[model samples]
Target: MPYAPKHPCTYPGCATLVDAGNGRCERHRIQERRELDRQRGSPAARGYGSRWRKARREFLRQSPLCAQCYVLGILRAATVVDHVIPHKGDSKLFWNQSNWQSLCKRCHDKKTVQDGRWK
Candidate 1:
């Protein structure tokens, strides 16, 4: 175990070295996790429990391509099951399959910013 690989933090412009398997350095990891928590709240609180997970799996199986990427002429696989319209705790809206869209991480992040979801 004498030779370990090193890489830059996933955070933008961060020079901290982290293990290859890790996404970010300790400090930036904490900061990013805190920000993500504040934005998304708890998964349970956001109605994303076991039931949601099951639905998500089924949805992804049905729509395996990123909708946004497809619209942009790219054929990326979908990794996130996103609500086309934010549910915002509305049960009816939350359960609507028609409102669901498959998105890759990149498209999902862009959509989150555009939807003002991270503010």
Candidate 2:
């Protein structure tokens, strides 16, 4: 029998379908894509500042599968480093690797809109 993606992620309150890429359903997948586009199109992104550019590249290089995707069994390409906690109050927390997670475009959007954590 062919493999089947598990329906309903194992995690509590997770809405992603395990089989879907990035672990999210179609809606979440679309959201992730849009978030990636916004990031790439951002003015700061275009500046090619050494810090920004290097961090972006390093983040991607360090992770392959989206962290959320992995949790739900979807292994899509990851493009963002998600912060576990918002960095607004603690700028020093921004650079902590333990605080970062890889996420596909879809999961990234879900996080952003749901909590505005990345904004």
Candidate 3:
């Protein structure tokens, strides 16, 4: 069988050649798919629409202290609102304010990665 014509991989700084119709090389294509799947399973995919945004803003307005930082004797301001237990696309769990906590960016990122929710 004839090999498909090749073109440069469209991924940034990549020097690999990919099939003409493909935007990324084989390795990069697989990486991209994994990244996309991560996003698809993220909270953003669970309808974190304007209502959620507004709720976050309001939650922060009411309490701007980082919950984790507070426990650690650090008085860091909260920059992100986090879900204590993952909602996992469940509307009831997602909207439960009792399950929410405020966190700083660093703390939120750490928790996200530790909980396998990082994209």
TM-score of 1: 0.67
TM-score of each: 0.67, 0.54, 0.66
TM for candidate 2 is 0.54
Ranking by TM-score: 1, 3, 2
lDDT of the structure predicted as candidate 2? 0.72
Give the range of the ten consecutive residues with the poorest summed lDDT in model 2: 43-52
- The candidate with the higher TM-score, 1 or 2, is 1
Which candidate's TM-score is highest?
Answer: 1
Q: After superposition, how far is residue 60 of candidate 2 from its true place, in Å?
A: 1.3
Q: What number of clashing residue pairs does each candidate have, in the order they appear?
A: 0, 2, 0
In terms of lDDT, which candidate is strongest?
1
Candidate 2 per-residue C-alpha lDDT over 1-119 given as tens digits, one digit per residue, 9 for 90 to 100: 77766687544576666673345656755777788878668645444367756886888897877988898987799987777786653557866778888888899899888885443
Off by over 4 Å in 2: 1-49, 117-119
Q: lDDT of candidate 1?
A: 0.91
Give the worst 10-residue stretch by lDDT in candidate 1: 1-10
User: Tell me, what's the RMSD of every candidate?
Assistant: 8.2, 11.5, 9.5
